[model samples]
Target: MTNPDKTGLKPTCREAHRLVSEGMDRELSFVERTRLRLHLMVCDGCTRFNGQMALLRTAMRRFPDEHGK
Candidate 1:
């Protein structure tokens, strides 16, 4: 998971997971995006996890509130 600039080594799964979450909240640095992409390319679990997070995020965003209280 070398960065676009080839700065550092690949990130671990934990780090990749964090990066995925961070990516949703804010723009990721090139290094972070690269590492996460590389990790997701190989890690099926994390890939699925990322998709699930996206699905859940969308669901929450679209959920309607009925109560005014």
Candidate 2:
């Protein structure tokens, strides 16, 4: 069996998950973002995962801790 990490054809799902969260936080490195984009192009599950992440971010922003207390 080929080592997926070396092949770069199958990055670990944990890496994908981390990339998704980093993308959400706008803190991903450029290469990380590019890899994530490539992965999402072929992975429906990651696409839906990103979509839900966006929704969660929007919801959190809309109901923030206003007082900072």
Candidate 3:
């Protein structure tokens, strides 16, 4: 869906960016998650970015301390 109409609606790319990071850390409200999903549907960059973030997170979890001390 396009940007929100008149009274503060869908998340913008900037907000979606924050949402992407937020989603990784904590549970988002249904409204927040829905807005992010809708944004990702239309924004290719964000979609890919989100995927990459998820992948990075997964890899980190799979291989802890990639940079050994």
Candidate 4:
């Protein structure tokens, strides 16, 4: 999708979330990471959401063996 920012930048929250969530395991193009970072900069809600997601990921990793998965 041709996402754009307030200043006509090539970035948006939807693209950022996808990169942060799915692109982490694979190689993220520089543009994707840049877009994610840009979205995190001016958007506190998305920033906090990203932080929480990271925290949850860390917690799950730490307790992976605790759950009988």
lDDT for each candidate structure: 0.80, 0.78, 0.83, 0.73
Predicted candidate 3 versus true structure: per-residue lDDT over 6-65, tens digit per residue? 235556788888999998999999888888888888899999989999998999788857
Give the alpha carbon lDDT tens digit for every residue of 1-69 in model 4: 542463354456676677778764787877777777877889887788789888988897878485576
Better of 1 and 4 by TM-score: 1
lDDT of 1 at 17: 81
TM-score, model 4 to reference? 0.69
Q: Please, what is the TM-score per model?
A: 0.73, 0.75, 0.78, 0.69
C-alpha-based local distance difference test score of model 2: 0.78
Where model 3 places Cα greater than 4 Å from the true spot, the runs are 1-7, 65-69
Candidate 2 lDDT by residue in tens digits, 1-69: 987674584456667878888777678877787778888888889889888998999998888596973
Candidate 3 at residue 21, lDDT? 92
For residue 41, model 3's alpha carbon misses the true position, in angstroms, by 0.9
Between candidates 1 and 3, name the one with more favorable lDDT.
Answer: 3
Q: Which stretches of candidate 4 lie over 4 Å from their true place?
A: 1-10, 66-69
Show where candidate 1 strays beyond 4 Å. Answer: 1-8, 65-69
Better of 3 and 4 by TM-score: 3
Once all C-alphas are superposed, what RMSD does model 3 give against the true structure?
A: 4.3
- Which one is best on lDDT? 3
